[model samples]
Target: MDVVALIGRILFVVLFLGSGFAHLTQTEAMSGYAASKGVPAAKLATQITGVMMIIGAVMILLGVWSDLGALLLVVFLIPTAVLMHAFWKETDAQAKQMEMIQFQKDLALGGAALLLFALYAKLGDDLGLTITGPLFK
Candidate 1:
């Protein structure tokens, strides 16, 4: 494996894992905020997102079918932006502002997931494998 690709995978691991930890650590806040966003079954959505983040993080870190992880995250984030942060119910100025912020965050996460998908092959090349690790093959 070349040095640069190794670095990229390391970066992927760090980024995903950190975000995952953030999700796992902030469930109550997340759930409350999601409730404000008018999400149905807010608690379940929060829990699901938290778990997905942790799982995605670990998958990226372990190099275990990280492409799939990336894809799944993209799928999750896109609907999240639309459903949880959509402007329909955000009549108040502050709520609208918060919705915009959340939408942007979700969009950014989706973009990051797409980038991971597009770059996974290069990453694998650098890591000397087609998947995250030996068992992932």
Candidate 2:
């Protein structure tokens, strides 16, 4: 069960980890797109959230302060979905569908993050983990 849980955590965080890397490596491109979407302080927001995403993923992966990590994801996802995936603002049918899909995906991931936080809070002790901890403690 522990192994399964570990694998699940790894799988869940892969996307976030990859995204963080992308944000760091492709800052100019991402920030430009973000600016086009009317995101204020686009580059700064990208860099900050990129770092947060990496930190959060690491915390969740190592089961160190997983709840806090999940909360970070929730924070990242909400504004990201709203600002980046505004499907309703699109007029092109195909573009709207694509944006809607991305929006829904972000919402689903945010919900999962919330669930992870709740589970960590409730079952941390049982799992020999702590919801709040100094990394890997």
| C-alpha lDDT of all candidate models, in order | 0.70, 0.87
* Candidate 1 weakest ten by summed lDDT: 128-137
TM-score of each: 0.68, 0.92
Worst 10 residues of 2 by lDDT: 128-137
lDDT of 1 by residue, 9-118 (tens): 56755655665566667777878888886788887887787678667666665567777677767877898889888866778999799889989988997898788766
Error of 2 at 137 (Å): 16
Task: Give per-residue CA lDDT, model 2, range 41-109, as digits (tens).
Answer: 999999988998998898889888887888899999988999999999999999999999999999999
Most TM-score-accurate candidate:
2
Scored by Cα lDDT, where does model 1 land? Answer: 0.70
lDDT of 2: 0.87
